[model samples]
Every structure is written in structure tokens, then in C-alpha cells.
Target: MTTSNFHGAVGTKAKPVTSQFQFGPWTLTAVKSHILESEGIARQRFEGELELPQVPEMIFADNVLRLQHVAGFGLEFNALDALKLVDAHNDPLKVAVAQAWKEARADCEHINEVVKPFDWTFTTEYKGTLIGKDGVQLKVEPTDERIDLEKLKVREKIHFYEDILLFDDELSDNGSSIMNVKIRVMPTSFFILLRQFMRVDNVVVRVLDTRLYHEAEKDFILREHSYKESKVQDIQGPPHIVTDPNQVAQLLPIKRETFEKLIFPSSSISQKEADAIR
Candidate 1:
């Protein structure tokens, strides 16, 4: 494993710090930057939204976790793209939160004559952004391939590991919204997990997780996404458990799950070629 650290200039003034790790034919990079200033072009990009969290700056475009393969394929997790999954229209969750806010603030001095609706909980189902070496976007196709959890359970030396935060918001004291990614590289394989966890106090708890696993010498990466959610009242556990996404994730049933693969074009060989080489 080879590791390096540096600062990359995103703009004239913003120097995002970056850490990179190289293992086998893959390179993993994480970029982190300070909160976006309220008056910048970056902040303007999020304008026109019905409502943003108090710490909206944390979702600035520059913060990301990226993995690239020598074969010209890459995957990235970024806050900007993840937040796009937040519903702009009036979803059931949004409507419920709005009503709760209205009732909670019924006696407030400045109640608006009309209320705008949005997903107050900031729930999202973004997996990861896939792209090719030429900057063209790629799509993950459904596949039978799956990550071997038993293999991962075996004790192995970790070559590299990193946890990268994309964004986090307190949701105006209603609850919390957070998106983060973690990657671990072993001698024989690498694994990544991108998680988006949202908690709307007394309303709902939601989690969306994306897992990617790639074994050394393999021509493809297996990707899995699982979405789980449950109403706060329906979850049966210690009250404090609700505050921890990791613990609560086990309680919530899986609402949806998907498996896909990202194949490296350069690594693929025809059967005839393989036979000839043999």
C-alpha cells in the first residue's frame, strides 16, 4: 500500500485537503474542505430550495470520496449529488414534518401565511456516482454478483482505511441528517461503505447504505445498496438506541435492496483469448 497526502486547490481561495491511498491497481482519494461561505457561488448553487439546514455549508460541492481504477472506471460519493435525492415535491414525510412544525410553532409571533413544503428530514437514496476515465457517466447494471461477507469476516491486515464525511445537518433540532463514506483496503481486496442516515425525532428514522467490494485480480466490483426505515414510535428498543444509526440499522427492516457490478473494460478478456493464453 502506498499513501500520500496533499492539498488540492479547488478555487483561488479554497484549498481542499486530500488524502490518497494506492493498492494494487486502484487509488482511493478523499477530499475535505471547510464549510462553504454563505455568499459564494457554491452557496448560490443551492438556492431556490424550499429550506436548507442550518449547516448547509457542510454540503459544499468540493467534499467527496472517490475511487479510481487503472482500467478507466471510477466511483464517487459527493454531498451535492446525494442531496438531490431529497424530494422537492410534497412527499408524505415532508407533509408530516410540516404539520408538526406548524403545531409546534402555533403560538410563535411570525407564522407565515403560507408554508412551503420540502423533505424536512433530508432523506436520500443516493448510492454513488459512477464515471468512466473520459469523464463520461456510467451506470451500474443489476447483477447476480454479491459481496462475500464471510470472506470479509476473516481476519486480515488492513493496508489502508479512511472515513470521509460528505455532509451533516442537525435538521433544525428536529433530528439529524448525515452522509459519510468509509473505505478499507486489505491485501487481497478493498471495500467501501457510503451511508446516509436521517432521523426525524418522533417521526421517522431512515438509512440508506451503499457497499462496494472489489477483490484483487478481479475484473469487476460488486456494489450493494440497502434502504431501511421505520417510524420512531414503531421501533422497539432503548430510547438511546434511536440516536445511533449503527445500532438502529439492525432494527429497521430492509425496505429495498439492490446488487450491481461495475466491470472494467480493459480487464475483460474473451474466452478464446483466455484459452489461447492457457
Candidate 2:
């Protein structure tokens, strides 16, 4: 068994969050606990992807600790209750779960196998487009406007064509260093067009969020395009950026509740109009 771990400064807490861990029959789940300990503290987001083998047995357990003065951290964990999986090839009690684990493992193995052949390279020809909130199309002159490709060369960044790949060290199998790739895209006019053909809005949302477009850009779209319609309401004001400087580097999704309530309620236009613009 192989394992991979990648760490990013996710708002200061040492806890991991939203990592596509390299190897595991199971993954650390979302933290159900959100206790605040300090006045200037921020919450941590913890999540993981799991891969379990066929006919396996496993158990999960945890231990909690209390901190004392000087903010001394106390730790507790049930190592005996560590990730475990039992083979249930014949047991009637484990048929469904066993089969599910088998399927999940198979999927992960396939992805690892397929992705291994890829050599990380900068994408210059993979032309991307951007669509605006209103329906206007923005001309994407890659040669002139491709300013971001250089910033990606910095430390802790690896661009995999359309997204950045992050590997987990603890869960890697067969020395496979990659766990998953995350894409960063602003929901511009061209993106909307691509979304139609690629179905990027659904599956892609897990890896990238398209709602990061600027209000000025969105307003430019509304002014240039004539069609306006939406199931939800339009946005009245600009997007409220997350102010915490620590979280700026971390990828996060647009708050769905906030999106529906504030932004989508006002600016979204009709699908028919969207089609006409295309």
C-alpha cells in the first residue's frame, strides 16, 4: 500500500481539508465538529477521497482532546480503530458494502493507471473561453492575454492542462504521486459556451468553481448582451470576497445559499437568450 500527503496553508489550522489523498481503503470524512477555541481563530475544512479494495474489512474510530492554558493542544486518537476493511466475499452482512468498496477501488485503480502515462506539461494549445453573466462573449487572445501561466510556475503549484494536480503522499499506490487535479476558472462568456458541450457545471464543480468572475466584467456582459432571464434572481451588488488573507490561496466554492439568494437572483438570463447569443 502507498500513501501520499500534500499540505497547504488552509486558514492556519493544522488540520487537512479537501485533499485527494493518495492511498486508502477509507478517507477522513468532513469534520462534523466546528468548535472555536480562540478569538482570532478560523475554521478548518477537512475532507478526503477514499479508495477501498474488494472484499475488505475496515473500522473507524476517533479520540478527542481538550486544550489548556497557553493554548496547549492535547491530542487523542484510536490507532487500534485505524482504517480497517474486512473481506466479505461470503458474508451476507457485508454484501452491499463490500461490493461498493470493490467498485470504488476499481475506479481509483483505473484512474491511477490512466493518469500515470501523462507527463506534466504546460498547456498552450488547450484554448479556453470565458462567458459573462449577461451573455456577451469575450475574445480570448491567448497570446496576448495569457498572463497567468507564468504565476503557476511558483512553488506548490503544478498545472495539468486545465487544472492543477495535487498528490497525497500517504495513500499513493505503486509510487503513484497524483491524487487528483483541481481546475481554476472564472465563469466568463466563453466558459458558459464550453459548459454547454462539456457539462462542466455539474461534475467540474467539484474541481473548480465558475462563479469567480468580477462584477465589472459581469456588468460589461449585461450591457453588451440583450437577453436576460433566470430561474433564480439576479445579483444586486458585487460579489463579497472572502476577506481572510490566509484563505486567499485556498480554493473554495461559492456559497450556494449566498449565490442563490444574492447573485443568481438578479443577473441570470434566459437559456433561449443564451442560445441566441451563441
CA lDDT, every prediction? 0.74, 0.21
Q: What is the TM-score of each candidate against the true structure?
A: 0.81, 0.17
Which portions of model 1 show Cα errors greater than 4 Å?
Answer: 6-14, 46-57, 94-96, 99-116, 135-139, 266-278
Question: Can you give the lDDT of residue 261 in candidate 2?
Answer: 9
Give the per-residue lDDT of model 2 (tens digit) for 1-278. Answer: 12334455558644432222111111111111222332232211111122212111111111111111111111112211111111112232222332333344565544345322211110011112222333423332212112232433344422111222121211112111111212322222211111100011111111112221112123211111011111111322222212221232133333331121012223334344444543
Model 2 ranges off by over 4 Å: 1-129, 144-172, 176-278
RMSD of each: 5.3, 22.1
> Under the 3 Å rule for N, CA and C atoms, how many clashes does model 2 have?
46
Best by lDDT: 1
